[model samples]
Target: MKKLAAGNWKMNGLAAHLSEAEALAGAHAQPGCEVLICPPATLIARMAQTLGDAPIALGGQDCHSADSGAHTGDVSAVMLKDAGASYVILGHSERRTDHKETDAAVRVKTEAAWRSNLTAIVCIGETLAEREDGKTLDVVGTQMKGALPDGCTAENVVVAYEPVWAIGTGKVPTMEQIAEVHDFMRTELTARFGDAAAGIRLLYGGSVKPDNADEIFAVSNVDGALVGGASLKADDFGGIIGALERA
Candidate 1:
């Protein structure tokens, strides 16, 4: 499976910012690993246009559980696919926190995304308190049981671990900590999902900036990263992509 560096530009980007997507697609037309950017929903169509036939894929930050609905301001997975998105991020730490999303909600959304043929990047993580209590693995395992659907496959599912304490806080877990979580995730997924779990990508999401990307990518089971702020700029994200290529 190709390593994936997926960017979640949550609630950011406009028509003027579409140039960064173009710059990324131009610079890394065919990096060794896969490149993806989930720009704000408003920029999806134009960004996809900017990245025509490029290796850099496009994704969405979130999606509604329903295929179609009367919910105002809610974009469904069906809508995201229609808008040219190949993937949709579900249960991001920010969405889980700000929206108070439970694991059951994430699973329904993942099923919806898969129904639309969109790969689901399901996020699972521990809060600062859970980490402090040494329950990170336990928390993540429980989330996997709740968020993942019964018929999931590697082709349609990816898992991202973003410590609530680390995301956008300029903080990062040690390489050992990251390795532990990734390895545990691989084990947990394999236990329930069977052989296909070996192919499922496990991504780390936090303060994944250029300077630390190379080392993070080197960790065992660390297939790639789910980028945040660094992904908003072409240069920074390109730097991370370069590191993954080298890894």
Candidate 2:
């Protein structure tokens, strides 16, 4: 399976920000891995056009459950697809906390992503308190079981593990710690879904940056990353991609 290096520009970007996508397009992406940028909804179509044939896929930050509805402030998966997004992020910790989104809600959104033929990057994570209490696995397991939609294949779903405490906090788990969690996740996935799990991609998030990208990518079952702050700058994001290439 190819590694995925996705950038989530969460709640940021404007019309003029399309230049960032252009900058990313001009940069050399790591060979053997896929690069995707999930810009705010407004720039998806323009970014897709800017990155045409550049090996960089365009995506959406989030999507609504219903395809088309009276949901005044929501953007549906169908609309994202129509705007040229090939992927949609779901169940991000920020969204879950800020919007009080439940696992069932995430499942609905995941199904909506598939309905529009978009790959869903489903996020599962543990809060600081849960981790401190050694309930990380339990929390993650529950999220996965509840958020994942039925009939999702490895091709259509990518799992991202982002410890809530670490996101944008300049903190990261040790290599051993990350390996333990990822290995456990892989085992759980295999047990639940059988051989199909082997091909599924598992990505780590939360403070992943160019400096630590190589070591993190070297960890077992860590196929790639969902980068946050580091992804804002073309050079920093490109450096992480370079690390993945070397790894």
Candidate 3:
């Protein structure tokens, strides 16, 4: 399976930031691994233009579960697809916290993404409190059971494990910790989805900077990374992409 290097621009990125994405596309026109950039919805169409003919793919930070409705201020999955987004991040920690999204909600949104022919990158992780309570696997497992829809395949679904405590805090878990979670996720997915699960890419997110990307990618079952802050700049994201290409 091809490894993935996904950059979540999060709530950041303006028209001015398109230059960075353009540079990233120019630098890695033929990366060894699949490269993706999820910029703010406002920039997806423009960035798609900037990256025209480049191997890099464009995505959206989030989307509403419904294809269309009077959901004010909400962009639906179909709308994102129409905007030139091939993927959409769902149930991100920030969205789960800020908007109080639940696993059921994420599951429906994932289905919505699929309905639009958009791949869904489902985000799941334990909070600092849950981690301290020693329920990391249990928390993520429950989230997975509820967040992921049936019929998920490698072509339409990806999973990202982002420890809430580590994101943007520059705090990385020991490699052992990351490996444990990833291994557990793989096991759980295999049990539920059988052979199809093996192809589903598992990504480790949270403070995934270029400096530590190689080591993270080396861990077992770590197919790639879902980068945060490091993804904002072309040089930083390219460095991580280089690490993945080497992985």
Best by lDDT: 3
Q: What is candidate 1's local distance difference test score? A: 0.92
lDDT of 2 by residue, 75-130 (tens): 99999999998999999999999999999999999999999999999999999999
Best of the two (2, 3) by lDDT: 3
lDDT by residue (55-170, candidate 3, tens digit) is: 98888989998999999999999889898999999999999999999999999999999999999999999989999999999999999999999998899999999999999999
Error of 1 at 120 (Å): 0.2
Which residue pairs come into collision in candidate 3? none
Worst 10 residues of 2 by lDDT: 24-33
Which candidate model has the greater TM-score, 2 or 3? 3
How many angstroms is residue 190 displaced in model 2 relative to the true structure, after the best TM-score fit?
A: 0.9
Poorest stretch of ten by lDDT in candidate 3: 49-58
Residue 115 lDDT in candidate 3: 97
The estimated TM-scores of all candidates read 0.98, 0.97, 0.99
lDDT of all predictions, in order shown?
0.92, 0.89, 0.94
RMSD of 1: 0.7
Query: Mind giving the per-residue lDDT tens digits that candidate 1 earns over 1-247?
Result: 8999999998888899988888888898778998889988988988888778988788899999999979999999998999899999999988998999999999999999999999999999998999999899899999999999987777999999999899999999999999999999999888998998989999999999999999999999999999999999999999999999999
